[model samples]
Target: MDISLWDQLQSMDKPQTTLNNSVDRVSDEAIERYARSKWLRHKVDDYIKDDKFRRKSVEAFHADLQKLSNNDAKSLLHVSNILDNRSLENIGLDSGDYRNLLITYLQSRQDPLSTYRELILYKIHNVLPEEYLGWFKDDLRCSLFLAYLVKDSIFINAYKGREELISVVTDYLRYEIHMFIEEYTQNLPAYKVDYKGVGEHKTVDILYAKSVYLKNRSKEKDLKWLDSSNQHQIDWTYNYLNEEKRSYIILEDIFFPQTKEEKYELIIASLDILSNVEGTDVESLAILKKRKGDTKIISRGNSERIDVIQRMKKAWVQLGTDTKNSKDKLVLNITNKNKEKLVALAKNVNQTPNKFINQAIEDVHREVFKIDG
Candidate 1:
């Protein structure tokens, strides 16, 4: 909250904020601009360090803003006018940058068309109500910081009223944060996958962008980056949970089927403990573009004529009884006479009957080498 910005809001007499009539609230645009100009990056290091100066700065800010009445929209937007040498960029309000802490703190004005006025009439007038106000004293610079308290609370919405305004502030915050990160660079790797243990017991894990992490020290392991469009993903991270061993992981963003009936079978086949996948709801069958010959599939989820779907199910059943694989492991406890339908159901969508039989083998091949259907 720049004191000058606060001063501009005071003149609007927005809704509530007002100060004691006894206090001298001066709308001296030149003086407020002069104060803002003094706290450039080089000057900021000193003000935040000194207690007396910080207090004096904020109080002076409050006083200067208190000057103008609620008819100062013109002055509020054109802060550049009062100061001859300072530009908006020169008035930095970055996370950990305290130049405009006072102004950003002001948020929406009580009488916004005017200055940094307090609500004299409201039941919650005077000092910032404890519940509504929060303060952060952090050195960890992040985009979240850039948007609101540190930047603009306009980006994140904890509730409905706050939620609606999030995008407006978030866009501005994104540009500012990106510029900040570019300026103060920290090279972080995106989307990593690590494997641990052996065979069926081995697990593949996932992570988003982690600001705080460590590298695997053991020379035996190397990082594999799986990049599509999103680079900010953290694919691998050291897991302290299992012990001293570091782990590699991959992010698999698979949306789950929405209907309970639809989800029960497909989700079971697709997800496993070691498979790094996530999901929320069901996917309606896609309006699939064809591979030209697959014109029948375009009509319905069911395969027609000789019934490709029915044949695939029959194949899976034969294979499950004869072959040993992961999917078969899931059905192990089910009495053979009880879940014949589920077994048949899984078989039906197993990508054709021969494919249904060789499915686990194909998965094995994929793990050994990067192959996709």
Candidate 2:
């Protein structure tokens, strides 16, 4: 519905006399007078109930009303005589201030498209499974984050043109909304609802309105709410994740928990390994967000994995195992005292006993045979 400036000003002339002292609402009289359609009237009603639009618009309208000309004061006085002056006063308006009040009231009505965009994005952030959000938000950055949020190949295939990217995001929004409403609200056999319901303020009508709005508005400013940047750190994150993509599909997978204790154990284990790696500075190269019991590990460094993998290779060689070739373990009976001595020697040289003993035996054998000479 396109309301011209002429229409907006013309509608303001009509009087809105209805009042409810108990709660703030746009009366049916005002709805019928201004909305001009049954569907829009229902949307207007829901819009008032919606905390986002109502609270914001009302607060803004009050502030703007104070700045409007005093010419409306006489009109406010006339309205006070016809309606509950106390209610008008409570809302910070004189009775004849009806024109601006009605205009503001109608303005508070949501554009179903914008409402849908907001709700779908909200659902993505708050209601969808955390795994999906984590995958898109944690790993993917820049416009790539928005691209992955769609979970479709279209944006990538299309070379991510601005309009094409927007279309993909909008398509995803509608798809998710349909799936959520069908699975949670409409499909009674599939989903068992508690007495309180899956969502309280988030009713089917509200969701449906938002979906309709999203479809209508996707081409316009639907994506304006999305941050200009992908809300991720710029430094090292992209390079690191890209480089380690094959080994670590998602960084969060490293911190996944079998139990709470195991989750913490993984964090400690990573820290222990990374901390002990020689010839590399893990702390300077990586950012690990660990505080006591918290299990989250955000690796925003490029060379952290490189350092860790190198250390693991060194450990395997020290254990008498070749990473590239299969090697059978060699066990020999040795006196406890000599074994202890070998362990001490290995510790002093920062080598495993297996590595130290093998090197010592080779050196003695070479000397006895004069192998090099």
Candidate 3:
């Protein structure tokens, strides 16, 4: 007799009989297993009746399957069969494809379209087994799947539209270009040139030039806050300098300005914005303009030749003064090995160790607070 039917018979009112003994002899483990099987079947039936619940059940199963280890082969095979029956190929993935695709996607930086496709495949793979296994409730599973679809669509459309993609790519490239410029400027050779006809011309590194220009052109109130707009302008200036011809001329002028001033002027003229925050040197602009009309005036040994160096020195002093007056100081006890490292880094950037330390503190403060001065 069927175990459930026997169980039912035992529950019915009846006189004591030998059959009762057989019913009572059934193992507790078997009865428990039967009860669990019935409960699971009922849940599955209910899930099938509701379209929304059915979809969620499948999504939950796939999510759980992603987190499973190799030890879960039996469960994995079961889920695979359900997915296969539901025509998994329609979404361009099969039972065994999800894990490998996800792993590849994580490791690769392929084009946006391919990445979006991989993401969609991963989300939609193997939906039926989860439903049968009751892995996630209807609402949560639907929500997670819907959310993934929406996000994936945005990325897909962004790529197709091109404008958004260009903007994102430009921002990323801008950051990389700015970083290279910063390093390049900080480590420029401090070479001096003495032309036979022209008086001695002192070379000003890019960072020093920028700092001096920013200080002299802007008011104290303007310099008090280096906000997002200021930072964007700074980034744009660095990116502009990253152009091959512009960078070459700038470096040549820094080393041999007496001979290369014309080339430098041409590069500087390419810059579109010339406001205070953009750090355009008005004196340099005026000199260049005058030289355009009569080259001999600029070619002659003029006091303006040394003005940039003097401005740079003044900027350094201002930085030190501001750091000293603005805040309380903290003393740190560091190991000699670390001290040696710091000293080496300071030397590389032509900074005193104390000034380097202050610069590092300021950098950290900006990172933590998202504010700058």
Please give, for residues 1-373, the per-residue lDDT of candidate 3 as tens digits: 4443223333445433332233222223332232223333333344335444322322232343355343122222323434345432322235455554443332333232233223223223321122222221222211122122123222232231223233332322221223333343222222121112221111122223333333333233422332233444334334445556534222222121121322222223222112222122455445444443222222323233133323433654676587888677667898999999999999999999999999998999999999966
Assess candidate 3 and give its TM-score to the true structure: 0.15
The residue ranges of model 3 lying beyond 4 angstroms of the native Cα positions read: 1-165, 168-272, 275-373
User: Relative to the unseen true structure, what is the C-alpha lDDT of residue 349 in candidate 1, on a scale of 0 to 100?
Assistant: 87
| Model 2 per-residue lDDT at 189 | 12
On a 0 to 100 scale, what is the lDDT of residue 193 in model 1?
31
Query: Would you list the C-alpha lDDT of every candidate in the order shown?
Result: 0.29, 0.36, 0.35
Worst 10 residues of 2 by lDDT: 186-195
Model 1 Cα displacement at 171 (Å)? 13
Q: Estimate each model's TM-score.
A: 0.17, 0.20, 0.15
Q: Cα deviation in Å at residue 186, candidate 2?
A: 25
* RMSD versus native structure for model 3: 28.6
Where model 2 places Cα greater than 4 Å from the true spot, the runs are: 1-8, 11-373
lDDT per residue, candidate 2, 1-373, as tens digits? Answer: 8774334433453224223321344334442322122343455456546654433323333443444333232233223332333333423345445555544433443442243233323433323232223222322121232333222323334332333333333333332433344333221111011122234432442343323222221122322322223323211222232355333222232122333333222222222222221222445323222222222334344234345444433543454345334445566999999989989999999999989989989999999999993
RMSD of each: 23.3, 21.1, 28.6
